[model samples]
Target: MQFEDVKNARDYIVYSQGMHSYSKAITKMMDLYLSYVPYVERAHQEGKKAIFCSALYPTTWEAPLLYALDTIPYATGEIGRLSDFRVMQIAEDYYQFPIETCSMVKCLVGQWHIRKDDPGAVKRILGVSSGCEPFNMAWETMKMQGFDVHNPDVIYRAKGVDGERLENLIKFFIRQLYRTIEWVSGSREFDEEKLRLEIQRKNRLLEKMRKVLELRLKRPYYIRSLPTILILNSGVANYFARPEEFEATLDLLIEELENIPVDEEENKKVIPLLWVGTTAQEFGIYEAIDQAGGALLGFRSSPNKLFREDVPPLEAIAYYLYDNQRAGAEIYMRRFLDEELGRINARGMILYGIIGCSYNSVEREMHRNYFHQKGIPSINLEGAFQLGGPTGQVLTRVKAFTEMLS
Candidate 1:
């Protein structure tokens, strides 16, 4: 779709959803999603390989390797907006998957079923071997279906492990990275210069995002909650393909934020809040918060940190993959959450998770109890990752939570 078409879609979404403002950045993000499949098709035509990934994997861990090998990256998480529910239903019905399966897995499987016969679609998947059973099983199903699937052995953090154990884990992860690279590129060695360039590009993007995040603290929120969530989602997933377009979009967003004037009356009504846990797929949650006079100041799913420049690019990525609290120990996750809440000066939090996501279900409660003990109010909400939007019950809880915060 063209830029104007994307802009019109964004406007319709905002108006239909009863959201507060329009965002050029969010429009560009929609454009990128629209452009993705065509880009992959063209890349395949030009003899470039394509690899599929889930949003569960850190983009930092995979983007550089893909770029160095000149491969196009397509993520199941990045496909479609409102149509995700239809795709997800196809997976559930066709595969006879249980209703309790993670929605993302069903969505991925559904996408696979729909595109399995498409010659230009990616058949090679980079899968994760650890964390989230449903996700792992989805990859296994794809492998059985004749797709070329490679699951890199990755482990979650263990308690009381440090020093030698930690070193060994990092080293093992680095080896897996190499194995994945070799599998995708058909070569044991990748161009270091290309990897370094991708690293530099990523760093530049992070710096820009940091500024946008800082700007989010401003009252009357020049950028709305949904746009910010979308941006952070892209940040965590590293855009994977054509990241430059995303970077340019950020520039426009930053400029707009810088020039926009804060509404003093709205600033007085704004109740700054934090969102913690799985990404909120429902657009209505943000609108509910807006309706309840809450401004989302920050969001955390993964640790908010940058890759190190002092170390080799690969080593830096490996370290981030190993240490980031997204998949790390409870202590690290708690520490990260506490620091982020304090940094954004959040008055309250929204702890969200997908239905049937055991991993996040446990996490949501842990975070709720932790924040409760700290005298910070938080409400936990669980819902499907469906496209039509959250149920009225979910929306009521979100609005009530934000209203209480206000």
Candidate 2:
């Protein structure tokens, strides 16, 4: 259930039959969990500070900032709320945060309450960039409750592929990124050298992810191992704190993958299914797919855009800015699905529509329609966060879809 070292973790992965990529993906997560116990104990004993923010924001860069400021970064979005839905309900039931608000946003409210009286609780919250209405509202509510909330002011719209508009978008994003760092540093000046080193490490992690993605593109069996899910879970576990541990797992994974020769005949028999919509699996989407016998090519989400390592920090931030400029409408996602599904040779898709997410829910019919036209079948599964859809129904649909594709 828990491994203190990576070797034992690898053995656990080998033993877990239906876990697919999850067992390995979760190893670094466990390492991070073990680190958290020490992190909390240290913060309490040594009087260290922590900053809370959304994981949606690129907080990996803050590792250097944390070291410079003598603080730790807590992505409440990933750790605080996603760990338990009851934490989110606390905001709605007790705090009277609007019941209609996004569950993730409401969870932030509950996170604040949980930490409000803690000896090492953080007072400053780095607000979100993407203005999901409920998220902004939650930020505003936290400000009212005396937390220093900093929201990056920027327009959220897709700047077309390659142009001056995209460049400008990147410039604007870099400016906001610098401002965020400056604000986080406050009286304590930022250590440029430290940040550069931290970013280099972050870029290295991204490069490893890029390699994993590259391998998955050519080898469908890699999907069964859930490399993408492993990447996502690494973030969920706040692997940024101990990136090398995460990298070590990557090393083991890469070594293991290299040894297992790609079976051409076996690959031909497996159905390639592209997962669309928000990345789930705090509730077991990856395991479900494994049980259903479908090979997931990858997810169609912001995670797909791997960060660039070669460029200068500012330019890289610009590239990141442009890459992350998600359109509010479903058109961009539709285009991505059309392009990627074909590229990956995906036979079918599973679109997980979050229950209260207005944007994703409205696009379900259009998603089904477009895939139908392309002769690619897709099932839309609905749920709140990763709690997921009805298990029997979801697995049945997944099995049926795989059977049809096969």
- Steric clashes per prediction: 0, 1
Candidate 2 — which residues are off by over 4 angstroms?
A: 1-49, 56-72, 80-85, 158-168, 187-189, 217-227, 233-240, 302-312, 324-330, 363-365, 386-391
The worst-scoring run of ten residues by lDDT in candidate 2 lies at: 2-11
Count of clashes in candidate 1 = 0
Give lDDT for model 2: 0.59
List candidate 1 stretches off by more than 4 Å: 1-26, 41-47, 55-60, 80-86, 262-265
Pick by TM-score: which candidate is best?
Answer: 1
TM-score of each predicted structure versus truth: 0.88, 0.78
lDDT of 2 at 178: 74
- What lDDT tens digits, residue by residue, belong to model 2 across residues 181-216? 677766434665665565566556556655665566
Clashing pairs in 2: 21-225
